[model samples]
Target: MSSTDTIVHILPPLTNQAQVDETYKSKNVTINTQEVTDRPVLRRDNTGLRNFLADSQDNQNVGYDGEVDTLRRLGRFYNWILTFSVVTRYAFYILPVATLLAIPLSIFATIHKESNIKGIKMMGLFVWLEIVWSSLWIAKLCSKTLPRAFRLCCGVISAGTRKHSLMIKALEVPLSIVFWVIACWASIPVIAAFNPETDVTVLGSNVHWIRSLQKGFLASVPVACVFLVEKVVIEFITVNYHRTQFSARIQESKRRMHLFELLYEASTILFAPYCPKFADDDYIINTSLLSTVGKEIQNVTDLQTGTPIRIFDNLGRLGTGVTSVFGNIVSEVTGGQRVDSKSPHAVVSWALERRPASEALARRVFNSLVSEGNDALYQKDIERVLGPDNHHEAEEIFHALDKDANGDVSLEEMTMIVIELGEGRRAMTKSLHDVDRAIKALDRILMCVVLVGAGLIYGTFFSDNFFKNMSLYTTSLMSFSFAFAGTVQEFTGSCIFLFVKHPYDVGDRVEINNVDLVVEHISLLYTVFRRVDSQRKVQIPNIVNNGNWIENISRSQAMSEHFALAISAATTFEEIENLTEELKEFVLADENRRDYKSDIDVEVANVGDMSKLELKINLGYKSNWSNEKLRVARRSKFMCALLATLRKVQINAPGGGDVAIGDASRPAYSVSVSDEEAKISRMKYLDEKESNKYVKDKGI
Candidate 1:
């Protein structure tokens, strides 16, 4: 018997309630003399094979088109928010200027209606055009302004959907062209009205206003042509540069996955014998079973369907983890808990080791951009960093790094870009610093230009009007000079004071303006410091730091840290004193501590009211161990201990009198206590210091 005649037929699983009649709507021949579709047929032992096939199909369905609907919606929503923010920012500048110009131009049009009809008409039209320009700007602002980061995210999320991209292109390209045309055309009437020689006449007869308007628009034709040519030139170079990089990345990915592809092929061959076939009596089954296997393997190999999604999902998880970790860190720091980023043993390990793991991480980010056996990164290296979906941004970054445009991004080229970027930042900062100088220079130039132009105009045409406003103009000049001098004098002393006396360097712990801060970075003009609690960077001018009572916390290695806790006035002094000693013991026994200043002082720092008194504790630690985070943590621990001690003596409360801070039944004694304990309890153990101290004292 033939293989087709000896075939076994198994019906697919009945996932739905379809009738046998509906299932067998199409004609089907017998398989091994059995009418498979006429009745309920079951595969006795092919469940594993069926499951594998089903899973393969499901995996295959994980394409950008199918999975990115949620991402696309999210992206659109984010884009709208960003667009609104950007437009709101622009409108603040544009609306005022537009209004300023419109009012003056409207006044000009009304006053000079008959005498200078042509010039007045031109001004009126330009005013209307300015309004139109403002409207168009509003429109452009409402439209999405997708930055590189957004583009990268969108690209990653839905690489297949070109819908948003296409829509943006369709809107922007024509809108830009139209706006440019309008601007160029509007400039023409102004130019013509200003020119003395060009009379608006056609065939020796005075031209109509409509004819003049037509001429202005017609004059924009050459400008449009020039604009198109320039755009085309830029597009040509940019498009080619991107295309080459994209192709290189594609080739590199395929090359990298060549071995996997081979393994896939071999698997297909190995599984061919076991692969089930659909037997047909009417035609020969010449097609290989490998086609089905290839489809299954393709699901695994396709980066678009597999890796990008996983990477983004992993990134999301990583973000969540980082946020949770950061929250914990903030919680610990804000509370003045004893624990820190480094415990005593950790600090010792870090200090003695000479290099931390974070250094390696920084190095990897910086150095691993380069590919193997190459001095510079190729397109693939960038793809590995930014991902394959972000060819546009990668190409842009690649071009920026590949300064000579030979397409290879060398390490030196990257370093040079960084240097240039740093220089640019410095230039911007210096420009801000020299704002007074710039204003002075600009003021002088503007004054001279205005005075000279006014003098010329007054002598020639508007002499009567100029003389009428001469006193007003002189008063304005005097006001301007006074303002400029006053501003310069105000800022000069501060600038000199900051530069001359460099009090604090970067990374110093200090209390400036009554805020405890870790100095992150100090620029020439401003000092950047991170607050102890939120980790938010606060930028204060050097002058402000100098003016404020700056207490350098890092001055001495071992300085006393003072913190206060509030308690009910009714609470016994014995309880307060006992709590203080427990806290002191807690502070003294810190294994992570390096300072070892065991001197602890407790006092009533403040008597707020008859209801409460501030319980103050003071301790000293090494300068190295004087991280605000560590201090905050230690404080949190003391607060926790205070709560525990308060729980021992309760006035009246519900829920077993646990002395919870926010609970309805929580004690008034514990009510004002800051740094509520986290839901997750943290238990501090003795560090190397405490262990060694115990060992030495016990003679073990």
Candidate 2:
């Protein structure tokens, strides 16, 4: 392909401080998601199947209880069934076929040998050789279905990985026959002598080979040590770190796979960033050196639903609620310490808080509150759990626990509240920041160990390893292998990027070269960020980020945003100050007090071209800019108020001027706005529109 035809992808540049003001002044941006619900529900004619068939299950026989019993029964005898199948397969399929195939090959061997072959010697070697050569072909009876299933699950991925050699494949059957004849003859004459059986004859001579000659394969001992050494080293990491991530990925998929599949169907490009795949421990352990069996699933259901566990009672006791914004709702978390109200670790601490002193009593109470699914609890449930006598307190608790202002207390909220009834506020003295740092440190150490191990193996076994003569070549090979490791790309940048000049960490809202992004994940090699504008994942290598300027909005002490506007030069400085005063009063209102600070800085920036004035304004938000929704909302609210204030002050924006010829000035501008009157008229118009002129819009 020519360079001119090559497609290059570029990240979208975000509207900057200057650009955003221009856009808003011209009223260019349409209504965005920030003003709407997180995700709007689009109504359409029901195209879905009825629940009776889609969720169909026979209550009497196919219930969870019965399904569990059935699985238990099958699991108990599964190993026995597998063992018997393998035995019967070799007895019924392999031996009979190998015997029949060996008949003609034995005849060819004898014709070449000019002597009759012996029993248990010629047949035994032929069987072993036949099994070794034809085993992969025999497995094709089952493997034939694998490619189809793989393609179904992998989507576009299979085409790139699938290999083809048409010339070799065309001669497959004929070449198999020719190779089998030569292999069968050689097996009886040469490799046959190495078989376990004694008194084996070769070339019409009785020859029993010595044991050392038979075990010639042991010469490759040094190369075989790598696998054994790897196993030994891996145990240390397992014992310390545990198999948490792999198991967590599988478990987490139970709740997320359906969503991922829907996203994939919606847009493959958007879904590629969240590719979900799983590997089975059983197959990976000992299946085959080259291939193993696993499933690419279309339909997957959780085997079991997890119930809250007990945390404290001696019967052996079991187990809040601040929510970190946009945390568990997705899978990214920010904020510094787990002790913080909304962090997942705080939820853990709440669960383990030794409440009511009895595990059985706690379970009984929870069961009483929610008899069916222990997910959400309503006001009635709160009354039932706490009793009718403490109804007032129960109401307060219910309201407090309803974090999202949804009517009921969700399971997450229930699990997260930390209770402290009798003491003055003493800060939780501990934080889980060190815990995260420790895990990262351990992961880095493991990465180094794996890299060095791979380099040593490549140098010693694969490359030409000479103690003295080819020492330089071997050393260079090892160096190349080590340097080629994925994490090596981060080596120079990581030290300074993380410790010395660190701009951001995971979950930070940042700006890199004017592109606003939220840090979703940080790895040794690259950082994954989601564009605040488009919500698409962007992977920037650490080495690349090291060369760019980064602004960490989340870490900054103060949070503010500024925008510029071009207003009609006819407006006096007194009118501008009056507009600024209107904004100040708007910020100070009780309803707006929660989200905004009183630090409103509105000023005339410049007298531009004698036709218009440049006005720049900066407003401080109450919270850090980490919450994208709130930041967008606050900016939107302020902008609307600013426009209203400008209208009230008769300050015309620069674009509506009319051409004047001597005394023939044609005034092309008219402005009239009253917030109270507009609200009343808008509500009335909406009611009339819904009653008569409503047009249902489907997203198409």
Give the candidate number with the greatest TM-score.
2
TM-score of each: 0.26, 0.35
lDDT of 2 by residue, 1-700 (tens): 4211121111122223233224333643211110011122232223122112122223323212111112345654654455556566445545667788788668746663433243334544555567555643543333444445555666565554232222223234433433443333334444454345545332332443322222222222322343334433433333222233223433433223232222112222222211221111111111110110112111112235322211101001000111223233434343333333322222122322333211311222233355366555687866664568978766765565454444665433343332221000111111113223534564566556656654555454443533454668667778888756756556646644644455665556899999999876665556789999999999997788999989888667547788899998888889888988988899888566655778799888898787889999998775577667667877899889888888898788785444564445655566798999999999999998889975788886
In each prediction, how many residue pairs overlap at the backbone (N, C-alpha, C within less than 3 A)? 14, 12
lDDT (Cα) of model 2: 0.47
User: Candidate 1 residues 422-467, lDDT tens each?
Assistant: 3333333343334334334434544554456544453433244767
The true-versus-predicted C-alpha distance at residue 318 of model 2, in Å, is 13
